[model samples]
Target: MISLTMEKRYEIGLDSYDRLFPNQDTMPKGGFGNLIALPLQKKARSNGNSEFVDGNFNSYEDQWFYLSNLKKVTIEKVEEILSIVEEREKEELNQ
Candidate 1:
């Protein structure tokens, strides 16, 4: 799934990753610029920290079922969203 939040994170990182880590040439080396620990870690899940929740913030009873049903977002859709975001940002800067 190509979530808006996830894509926005990628967009922001593309713009700011190097400035945030001047000493490290991570992006140039094909790195994502940072390491994010895998979600749903056993310990974190047990503590109610890493579980996916619903819009109402209720934990789903069948996380695996929910995950299995998610449809994949296409690359075209992602590029479209990125272009919209870029245009919006430009408008904001001009305001």
Candidate 2:
């Protein structure tokens, strides 16, 4: 969910529906988009480098405590965000 939001915010990659927006031309040229490393691998998790953080960028002392409280991102919310992004892009193009 965070990844989707960040991709839209950065205007990169395809949306949740795998549709590419005009701001990003990631796939039309037959090139795959950039690959990203998964967070919190064994070593990074131990060193706290790839751990998830809060608004202040502080990783929680108990990673499991944070994971346990995570809520699933709803499909409706994803659609809503995509619609909002589409509208914003349209307005930008009109200007």
Candidate 3:
């Protein structure tokens, strides 16, 4: 699954495996573009030390670590989406 991310939105292409799933009769008809958007906002905090309260901490090492974890989650999500497409293809092939 080819994936792309822009801002807070993500999209994955599923055109190559179109033959795997049943046609529109069995499934909703749509293009290969599966998109997901996550609008992020800094949560308000009572502690003045909160990252949101102290904007300078945005680039802290801990923040980078958190972002790294988020990157892993994003990768996993893309893989999960591709697995669905692969499963449909396999089912079609078996039929």
Candidate 4:
């Protein structure tokens, strides 16, 4: 399995919902608006062939390119973003 770390940054604003639920809900429960990064590993499979093949080589490159498209984020950065969102939510709730 290929393991990779991700880093994310975010800017959040307070709104009506934030006012309803502040520190009680520091995070979005679930929705497309939530950002998520998942680590995955892919195994190369051959078509009934024990020997290495050209197709296998190509598959590795394809996987690399696909993963490269995803943004790399650090754990600290994610925490920072989450904190910002939570703070905004708290402020909204106070107002």
Q: Pick the candidate with the highest lDDT.
A: 2
TM-score of 3: 0.24
What is the model-wide C-alpha lDDT for candidate 4?
A: 0.45
Over the stretch 1-95, how does candidate 3's per-residue lDDT look in tens digits? Answer: 12222223444335534553233223236542222111122332223333321256543435435545543458888999999999999999999
Q: What is the model-wide C-alpha lDDT for candidate 2? A: 0.68
- Per-residue lDDT tens digits for candidate 4, residues 1-93, read 011111121233334133331223334456322122212322213333222225445434354466667688999999999999999999999
Lowest lDDT sum, 10 consecutive residues, model 3, at: 32-41
**lDDT, candidate 1, 1-95, per-residue tens:** 22344476665444443443343433446553433332445666788877778999998888778877889999999999999999999999999
**Superposition TM-score, candidate 1 onto the true structure:** 0.56
The candidate, 1 or 3, that scores higher on TM-score is 1
- Cα lDDT of model 2 by residue, 1-95, tens digit: 44567666876434434633443434447543332333645666787668889999988887778978999999999999999999999999999
**Cα lDDT, model 3, residue 38:** 13
- Per-model clash counts, in order, read 0, 0, 0, 4
Tell how far residue 1 is off in model 3, in angstroms.
33
The alpha-carbon lDDT assigned to residue 28 of candidate 1 equals 45
Once fitted onto the true fold, the runs of candidate 3 whose alpha carbons sit more than 4 angstroms away are: 1-73
Query: Which model scores highest in TM-score?
Result: 1
The whole-model lDDT of each prediction reads 0.66, 0.68, 0.44, 0.45
Looking at model 4, the pairs that clash are 6-73, 7-72, 7-73, 7-74
Query: What TM-score would every model get versus the actual structure?
Result: 0.56, 0.53, 0.24, 0.30
